[model samples]
Target: MTDPAIPLGEIVLPCLNEARALPWVLSRIPDGWRAVVVDNGSTDGSAGIARDLGARVVHEPRRGFGAACHAGLLAAEAEIVAFCDCDASLDPGAAERIAAPVRQGSADLVLARRRPTGRGAWPLHARAGNLALARMVRRRTGLGLRDLGPLRAARRRALLELGLTDRRSGYPLQMVVRAADAGWRVEETEVPYRPRTGRSKVTGTWRGTWQTVHDMRKVLR
Candidate 1:
């Protein structure tokens, strides 16, 4: 029951030193879907790996996660765009799930809520932050988000209409808030979130955690 409005779109993966996991992530993408990999100044050969795997490479010198994602969105030709992390934390096939609501014209933005399955995978602090952010988003925007996860899909027109302008680590939450404020139809899918292949840039570092919280609060305000 694939939604018909789900036009052929591009998948954007933001990579920063993800050489080890890029191959697996790229390989898992379903055929016929174009991919754009934004290399956020990776010292590793992540951009090269993505290019070799048939992804259109976009160089984003900026270090922010949102910057890389925004670059990919601008580079993509597809009307519908999907953004996901390059750490292999999400299922590639789940793109279909995100696209379903859009295809049916029921939603313009589809966010994947991570339902962690494996033992001791997601860190406690990260989980707490995710839950707190979701609560704040629901309270502030009246948009119920199960999680502020990386895997999400949206139509280009809707994204632009929402003015999704977070060019930093808190981009996910910002986009959701803007979409809600703009009255875009939004949906959330419960997808499994696995442990990433490499060290997570945000969840694995204290500075990143603080920056994420601070930026998210700004977005909320």
Candidate 2:
């Protein structure tokens, strides 16, 4: 049975050493909503902070973005599930935007576009690579997606039925690609993006970007 304290929809936060940012992220969840934070083997005590701040913490021993995200989905008992990163780059309240379309029956999936609020919000190399990759995805898959953002929402049943298998940085990419090919109604909304509290695990460095791109390319094939 779903917990009564958890409202109609739930938000999942995949965390990897994001202790400093949990307080800010957890504080912004809309009233009556629930947050599930999946700790992806963080030695930094991120799970403790998330628990203290009222989020249900699910420890995922595996240390990959997709693994944590999948664990969060498994823990979620709500009918609607939204995924968000706990890097403090995204506004936690933006859960409303992601959930609204699905709740209103207008769309099956929604992706949040990261509109950086200031300089340094996104890296130059990441930006260039993201543009090229987004174009490639649109041309090949025809999803009309602009960003492979962490802040996204969908009916839990629909998401799980896609049979997603990627468990790394390619996880989100696989979700987007599969959903598009499955004929899901996907949409995008703009959300304020700020600088993250700590160094990015992906999209902030050359090595991380390379791995992400490589993994995503593999998923596309």
Candidate 3:
């Protein structure tokens, strides 16, 4: 049966050196929904793989996750915009859940909460840090979000109305906080999260983690 909640729109994938996982990610997407892949200066052939898999590719030279996401969002020509990491951690079917609230006109933004599907999926520190950040967000903005996970869906108009300015790595937190501050109806849904295909950009490296934290701090203020 056709999902009544799935919006007629496109999904945007922001990628960097994700050639190995692109095909798997593309294959999981349901038919009738198009995808736009934003290649953020990938040294590998991630763009080529995406193109071969029938995804429209956009090149963004800037090396920031937020920048890539913003570029993809602007390029999307759909009413509802879904964004996911190209690493395949998020279940593709969860897109329907994320878009459901928006399609029903009940929420402007839907954030996915990631629950580890198996052992050794998410590192201990990362999980703890994410929970702490979520708590902090709830305390500051009075908006409870389970996870600022990469899997998310929102109305394009509502996203634009939030006036997102952070073009760095902290884009996810910035987006949620801004949406809450704008009084947008935000909802959360549980999504299964598995380990990615390649090395994690943020948690795998200390430099990446530090940079992410710094960027997040800058945007939180």
Off by over 4 Å in 3: 1-7
62-174 in candidate 1: lDDT tens per residue? 78888998888888777778888889888776786787788678888888888887865687878877787888998998886778868888887667666678889778888
Error (Å) of candidate 3 at residue 89 is: 0.8
TM-score per candidate: 0.93, 0.95, 0.93
Q: Between 2 and 3, whose TM-score is larger?
A: 2
Q: What local lDDT does model 2 show for residue 30? A: 81
Models sorted by lDDT, best on top: 2, 3, 1
Ranked by TM-score, top first: 2, 1, 3
* Local lDDT at 13 for model 2: 93
Which one wins by TM-score: 1 or 2? Answer: 2
In model 2, the clashing pairs are none
Query: Considering lDDT, which of the candidate structures 1 and 2 is the better prediction for this target?
Result: 2
Q: For each candidate, C-alpha RMSD in Å?
A: 3.2, 1.6, 3.2
- Given candidate 2, what's the lDDT at residue 7? 80
What TM-score number comes out for model 3? 0.93
Report the C-alpha lDDT of model 3 over 93-191, residue by residue, as the tens digit: 567767988989998888888889977678776776677678878887798787887789998877877778888878988998888888888888888
For candidate 2, the 10 contiguous residues with the lowest summed lDDT are 1-10
